[model samples]
Structures are given as C-alpha cells and as structure tokens.
Target: MTIGLMLNALGAGVGATTVDATARDTPSASSFGIGAAIWVLISNLIGLAVGAYVAARLSGTSDNTDGTLHGLAVWGTTFLISAVLLGNLVAGIASTAATSASSVLGGVVRGAGSAASAASNVAGPGGLQSATQGMVDRVQRALSGGGSPASMTSDQRNAEMATLATRWVTDGRMTASDRERLNALVAAEYNIPVQEAQQRVQQAEQQAAEAVRRAEETARQAADTAASGAATAGFAIFGIMLLGALAAVFGARRGTRDVLLVRGTGNVR
Candidate 1:
C-alpha cells in the first residue's frame, strides 16, 4: 500500500503539472479532470497488484487458495496503513485551518477593542471635562428620546453595533424596530434630517445585502468543489480496490500453477 500511495502521489503531481502547462493559455484551464483521476486509479491498482504478486510468489504455496489468501492479506495490510496515515494528515490540515481562522477573527476583535479604548481616552487627563464630554453634551441636546445611543461611551456603542450586525447576518435582514433605532441614532449623532438618515440606512442595507450575496456565492462554490473532489475520490477508491483484488487473484493462480508444474516435472525426472 505504501508503494501504491507513493506512485499515486507522484503520478498525480506530474499529471496535474502537465495538464496545467498544456492549458496555461486556455480559459478553462484546470489541473483536475477525468484523465488525472484515471491516472491515479491506475497507478494505485498497478502498485497494489505488484505487491500482491510478490507476496504470492514468496509464499511458496502449491495451493491456489493459499496464494490468493496471502495476496489478499498484503492488500489489506497496506490499505489499513495508508488509511491511518492519510487520516492523520487530513486531520492535521483541518486543525491548522481552523486555528488560522480563529486567530484572524481574534485579531479583528482586538483591533475593535483598541479603537474603542482610543475613543474613550480622547478625554485625556481632564476626565469628563474634555472634548469627548462636549460631544456628549451636544448628543444629549440633539436626542429627544432618553434612550439615545449617542449617550453611550464609544466601547458601549461599538458593542451595540456589533450585536446589531450579528443579528442582521444571522437573520438575513434588519428588523423594522432595529432599523428605526439605527436611523434615530444616526440622525442624532450626525445632526441630519430624518429623510437623509433614512437614505443612509437604506444604502447601508443595500451594501450589507451585496456582501451577504457574495459570501453565499463563495460558500456555494467551495461546497461544489468539495463535492466534486469527494465523488472523484470515491470512484477512484472503488475501482482501484476491485482491480487490485482481481490482479491478486490472477497472480496467485499463476504462482500456484508454476509451483505445481515444477513439482510434477521433478517427480517425472
């Protein structure tokens, strides 16, 4: 199985490189295709067959059944070993990808935290008697409602916005109540007319919708690629295993016949 895996990997690499070079100028250039899959299947089948044949020949069995069993054992042992190694490799890759994604998300969170800290510290040593306080006083005068988000500290405002954005993403749209609150906050903070605030909200909504559409499309393409790869792998595995079994049986039969012929010839002599 080890030999088979090595040959399959080498053949796949060469085949993919060759295909890529040949299709370099083509619009539909792709390294993966039916040809590549077939090549991998054939390489593995040949390797496993060769291994099985060698085992049968070395077993020195006159019985075809015994030789066949030995060949089957070889194929089974190699397959198990390969499966364990491949499984570990795949697990390692998945773990690394997950860790990288988490790290990126954590960095974004940390950046947001730093920005909020900077906003809060704009008051400097003057405490509440700073420029930030002046802005707060103006916001209080602008907002008629006591629940204006403009009165929130920068960190609180950031947290609220994050929560709203999360809700929009999860629900696929902003609720009317959330939109109204957001519009009120925007109008109070920017000292804009209600109509202009509504327009701004509408534009933000459109942009968010576009972003969601793009994310969905990207996810769909990734899923399609994964599905195609999985289907191809499944077919290759089935074909290779079947071919390996047949090759081993044939090799065993030939080995047994040769051994019996040699023994009979010796008896006659």
Candidate 2:
C-alpha cells in the first residue's frame, strides 16, 4: 500500500503537468516536477519503514504467513499516511489560487467596462455630440498642473471638437445621416450647421482612447488568470502526495495481518 500510494502520487503529478502544459501552450508548465518527485521519494521511504515495523508487531507468529502479512502492512500504511498529510495541503493551495484568479478576472472585466463607458460618453445621437465630447476630454487630459475638465478655454475646446468631427466624418466612423443629425443637434443647441458642429468635436480621440484602455485591461486579466492557475496546481499536487502516503501506511498493516492469518490456517489445514 505504501508503494502503491507513492506510485499513485507520482502518476498524478505527471498527469497534472502534462495536462496543464498542453492546455497552457507553455513549455515550463511542470517547473515543480522535481520538487514533487523528491517529496514522494522521501516520504514513501519513511512510510515503508513504519508500516513494516507495525505489521511485524501485530503478527503473533513468525512464519511465512507473517512475512507476507508484513509486506501488505507496509504498503497499506504508506498509502494512508501520504493521503492524509498531502491531501489537505494540496486542497488549500489550489483553493487560494482559484480565488486569486477569480479576483483578477473580475478586476479586468470591470476595467474594460469602465473604459468603454468613458468612450461612450463622448458619442451623441449625431456624430456632433461624440465629436464635442472627444475634444473636451483631450483638452482636459492635456492640461498642465491638471486642474479640472472645466479649465480648458472655450475657444480651445471648440477648435478641438471641430477637428474631431471632421476626422470622424472622413474616417467612415460617421455617416452622412450621422453628420446631419449632429448638425441638427448643434443648430438647436448653438444655432450652428452640421459642418460647424463637425469643427467643434473630434473623432479619432474617442477610438484611440477606448482602444488603449481595452488593451491594458485585457493584458491584466490574462496575467491574473495565469498566475492563479499555476499556484492552484502546485498546492493541489502537494496535498495529494501527502494523503497518498498516509493511506499506504495504515492500509499496509491491516493487509499484512490478514495475509498472515490466512497462511497460518492454511499450513495447519
């Protein structure tokens, strides 16, 4: 049982490494392989000795039957020991990693959403609103000593918006209908035409700003998930090996005793 438990742990570790590496498309997925192997070897050796000693003591007769029983005892105890000690450890670590990953994923999604929303604020029913908003945001972004959104001069804000609207119209981001709508809204708000409205707002600013935010958010989320998965897998493997050792130890003792009894009765019969 002890040997079996050790083998089981080793096999499980290998399987986990293979699966993780394949899934992640990374070559270093099994970086902890050496550590896991070493733990198994050392712990199993100890379990084997303990199991053999216990089995010998339990067997009343020193015969071939008893010898066989001892072997079984050693195996069983090894498994039991490994399982109890390692299982809990692995579970705790894996849980922590999973939690971390979840947190990272949530943060990334929230960041992305916020960026999209910020860009959307500049867009209006007509291209005019979006153009105007883009200009205001850019000027505000560029201010020295960073005062407030209200700090930009009205003329500077107007010039920026007009530049943005023209760019939006030319870039195919806005259509004729969009321009017309923008003009109507501008005329209603400031008695200006669609052309004049275009001069008031900018287009490239909106797409550029949103794009940058989206990229950053995506990268952060990916990194968080990767780190979490690595931690979880390492802890889970450690726990499994420890538990397996425990199972092997206790199990070996019982098996050995049963075998000895069977042999003794057989010899008498």
Full-model lDDT for every candidate: 0.74, 0.60
Residues 92-153, model 2: lDDT tens digits? 99999999999999999999999877777665456767687898887665433212224444
Per-model TM values vs. the true structure: 0.55, 0.31
- Alpha-carbon RMSD, each predicted model: 7.5, 15.8
Q: 58-151 in candidate 1: lDDT tens per residue?
A: 8877777888898788778777887898999999999999999999999999999998788667746676467767888766544334365667
In terms of lDDT, model 2 sits at: 0.60
- Report, for all candidates in order, the number of backbone clashes: 0, 54
Pairs that clash in candidate 1: none
* Number of the predicted model whose lDDT against the real structure is largest: 1
